[model samples]
Target: MEASRQTSPPDSISQDVNPVFFQQLRDLDIPEEAAKQALLHTGNVSAEEAAMYYFNKLENEEADGDLMYKMVFVVNMDLAMGVGKIAAQVGHAAVGLYQALQDKNSWREMAWKWDHSGAKKIVVQGTSVAHLLELQAQAMSLNLPTYLVQDAGLTQVASGSRTVLAVMGEEDIVNNVTGSLKLL
Candidate 1:
């Protein structure tokens, strides 16, 4: 006896998604679950539109009386530093940026909330030293607190090497600067 195979309806198959849409979501660095939820909520609209919807939803959530803080560390991929070296550089940036903000009374509340909320941070890859510097300039233009870490040549990079650029602020504002970059 032969067994019959069942196939999902065309409508259900259409929801499976195209590879290009998934790729776009990956390129945007959206989490897999978030992408899925966005597609579902948006009725499988174009990737760009879905992304906009997702980000808008996030912004709305943040605006509803709960502020979310985020710190982004842009590390120069050209340096090719070892994991330990990169960690050290990020550490330096985080501490330096925190101390700098702590000294300012206006920013102390942000720093305190960030610390209390677990200090959310994302490490993104930068193409080169110039790229990191450009990001720092952009952050400054946005009036976001930024710190650039330069190594002392004790280990991996040369003296005065710009290792990492750290930017800290509200989640939405920080994303405006680092959203295009991919996670390291």
Candidate 2:
């Protein structure tokens, strides 16, 4: 898959990438960012090994194309929020998750990939606050970044009500977490 890699390091891996292996990867026609990530993930392993990992990731559509990453907003249907309120809550969840991801090394990379890969977002419904928490837990266990948006009392929901949960990760893994939920 084609990738317009950013100049910034992938996954915040600031260490210098091995020049020789990088060349080898480029020789193999792998995208620069994907090559860098493959090298980072495989450590000091040889070019062959890193290339294998890269191809495998691509085969799984976890590399840089298709639905590589996505952000999911799960709204608490239990709340009696107006359409505007739900929109506001989802907006809050998106901004909150983004702010939170900036400080995270790996998650920041996911954000970059998501932004480049169409920034797919799905708004789904949750039964209640408890259900949101359960989904958040499931997402976290898979190493995905999650943000649960709590409402301020001035809004439709009561103060500290879990109005939305924003989860970001690889599309397939995220599917395992909230794929069953009905769309909002």
The estimated TM-scores of all candidates read 0.64, 0.65
lDDT of 1 by residue, 57-139 (tens): 67776787758788999999999999999999999999999988987786788887675444788999999999988888888
**Cα lDDT for residue 64, model 2?**
32
Error of model 2, residue 114, in angstroms: 0.4
Clashing pairs in 2: none
TM-score result, candidate 2: 0.65
RMSD in Å for all candidates: 11.1, 11.3
Q: Give the whole-model CA lDDT for all candidates, comma-separated.
A: 0.83, 0.86
After aligning candidate 2 to the native by TM-score, how far in Å is the CA of 35 from where it should be? 25
Best by lDDT: 2
